[model samples]
Target chain A: MRDASRAASGRKVCLLTGAAGILGATFCRRWRHEYDICAVYRGGRLQVPTQEEWFIDPLSPHAALRENDNPVFAVKSNLREPAEVQRVVDLALARFGRIDLVVNAAVHVDRDRLTSLASSSDLLDETFAVNATLPIQLAAIVCRQFWQHSRQDNQAWGRNVINLSSMASLGVVAGVGLSAYSASKAALNMLTAHLAAELAPIGVRANVLAPTSFPQLVPTSLVADTVVDLDRSDLTGCIVQLDENGLRETPSAPSALHF
Target chain B: MTMPEPRTLQAVNDLQPLLQARRWRWRATPFPHIVAENVFVPDVQEELARDFRTLYDQRTTAGYNTQHDFLGTSLISTQCGSLEVFISPAWYALFTRLFGINEPGFLTAGVHRHRPGSRNGFPHNDIFPERLDVGPGRGDVLRFGGPVAGKSVRAVAILYYLNNGPWAPGDGGETSLYWDWKDGVDTPVDSVPPRDNTLFAFSCNPHSYHSFRTNRKRRDSVISFVYRGVDDYVQLWGDEGLRQYAEYGRHHA
Candidate 1:
């Protein structure tokens, strides 16, 4: 739930999941001033700077905003449960008045890659619940809210959903233990595509950003930048892959002209 | 091995008028790509088609997927007398100018012969990130050795259909470009028919995804690659992007 004391009027509302994760945290810190962030982190609250190295800078991106007036509403919720998802949505709406952007950045990675598929069914199930299914459910609820609050004034602002996926989902990035993670992300890609097509008439946009997440290979900031760019652009139902080769639209359409 | 005859260069020069007249259709969707038809004069096209068999001694089976197979060989490795027309300076300039490749790179050409039932080529950009490690002077039966890392990045890929044989839409073997991938190769968004005197080419990048399906007829085309420096690719994609390519190439190479 948002801290009622903070004043974040006029700014767009961003419901960001995986708020504590590397990508999520970076996004929050970088864009704190731009949007009224509803930062959703499960497991625990955002930890202060400690002895251990953290994925994001100890000073949250919203620290300046925090010193003056807080715009980030940190919420803790396990999105797998329907009630929790609804509670978060309801809380966000009550606090921020409206939600303009949804960034489903939370993910479940199966660390135990050695286990066989038959034995790791539980892990696979959990992976799908968090990575793939939750995004669909949350988007459905959010879109319903948008439809209910349809006004020509707010419609012009346009709502957007950006789902963070991995390069593994394309099956081009091969690794032994990535089957479950890959499958779930692939499902997310298809769902987002369908959602984009279906929601286009309603002035809502949905897109998937599949970036190579190896920190050493592709920087985390590049991924964040791509997401922001995707949000700013009119591209919907597009699965944009960012890597060493830069941004490329998957299943790229060939352009040839013949006289 | 026989050296290419001087007249082949002359023939390539004579096609300049037709090449200039060609209206290339370019598109940035999916990725940067271009296509132009009626690329060659009829006489030159017929002559190249008739001599296609001379470019190879014996075609070798190649391709990744089990369901797909085709006979392919490097024309330069064969040193056929007619190979000069493709590797000639005029031809090389046309490719570089069309693709806007600024760097100096070697031009290598190969022929892929796909027969009926040997359909469905896998989608790939033809840039092998792992090939950069293989040092020069290790020229194989497929390609000539160039400077270090020059053999690694394929800057551009151009396919000129040599068979000048009658072709139709249903005949298949159209080099298809895709918009996305599913379990296997999904239906291509656009397909270039393997028609005579037609030229299909694109700048080889990570997003230049393309494949082909050979359904009924024997599909034959001279596939040429412009091998640029690793630095050029690195400059565009960054070191990490190259590393990612290398990593992906390790698993799939």
Candidate 2:
């Protein structure tokens, strides 16, 4: 539940999962002023910097906005369950009355190899549930709300859903046991494309930003910038790959079971 | 060592008049360019398309800068047997006669593939005469003595589309010719779609400002550069350009 005593603000609301992760934390610290964030984390609490600790440094390209107190509303929830994902979406709406962006940054990377595939079935199932299913459920929930609200409001702004993915979804990562992780991310990429195509008529856009390099090697700010760029632009159904050079669009590989 | 069939050469020869007729100046500029459709016979077009597909599949490396994202490879890499069809002495003689140049000075020849969401190249002329330097250890520099004296040799570029069929309107990946830059805007004068077997040729000059953008579908083409006086051309963009091209050539080699 939101603290009703905090004044209802007119800023756009962003429901960001994995708020405790490195990329998510950087986004929260940088975009707090531009968005009223509903920060959702699964395991641990996110330690956001206070105003005294947060100096007036430029956070992003849209960093000119003045910072406000307690722009982020942290919610603790287990994303594996469908009910908990719904709660995160409901909490954002209750807190800000509108959800403009959904950043599905949470991921479950359990190492498993093809040789031990049968032994790792449980972990594979859990990985898919957390990484792929949760994102789709959250998108459905938010899109439903946006559709209902737009019927009454004539000037509804465009809503955006950004799914953070990895390059392993497109190509094999050498020497890494990522069978489950790769499958989950590949499915997530497809979900993003499907959502973009279906939701475009309703003014909702979806895209996947998969970094070609390791997450730690690529700057978090670049990821943040890509998210902002995708949000602001009218591009949909794009699978953009971030590398050392910059962002480039990659083709979605075909599924094995083609009917 | 396979060559284009005699019928293919005849068909291409038959389109010379149409290509010459399509030549026009953009926005009163003296830049000469021609876009001809159905330049090659169906069999040759199919062969080129197959070669490009094989190259695209075997492409292990690609590079991107601010200007464009390109998959650079050669016939040597793909090991396609149709190399002689594109670089035959007869074809060189035909181009020399068609363009009425003194000699066919082949500069660079390779396959270019741009997949969906690739960046559009910026508007710029291909020739940079002022940047050319014939210093020690540098590659051979060709000197022009006639009307183009003191100026570095200008080249003519040919783009042969290897797409299997006609492209839809606004499908992008079309080579765009610009008239001039106005208020930081690239004013497009004409655009040639990547139609099957279509060929676009133009002289690389100061007035030759052109760009290309890839659409959602893949774009494949064979692009070759030919200079008038120079036997070979080397684009020297200071040390950085040299280093980048050396690395690029090494990777694609």
| B56-166: candidate 1 lDDT, tens digit per residue | 434443333343376776565455455456766556666676667777767777777787867576666566643543344543212233454433578888888867388
Q: How well is candidate 2 docked (DockQ)?
A: 0.00
Q: Give every collision pair in model 2.
A: none
What is the Å distance of residue B173 in model 2 from its true position?
Answer: 62
What are the per-candidate TM-scores when only chain A is compared? 0.81, 0.81
In candidate 1 chain A, what residue range of length 10 has the lowest lDDT sum? A50-59
**After TM-score superposition, what is the CA distance of residue A77 in candidate 1 from its true location, in Å?**
0.8
lDDT for each residue of candidate 2 in A1-259, tens digit (9 for 90 to 100): 0111212335667889998887888888877777788888875435463321221211121233343355478786888765887788888888778887889998888786766666657777888888888887898888786554462231245466889988889877777678888889999999888877766656666788898654567888778777777666555677888888887865353321100
* Candidate 2, B93-126: lDDT as tens digits: 4444445556434343567778777766655556
Against the true chain A, what TM-score does chain A of candidate 1 give?
Answer: 0.81
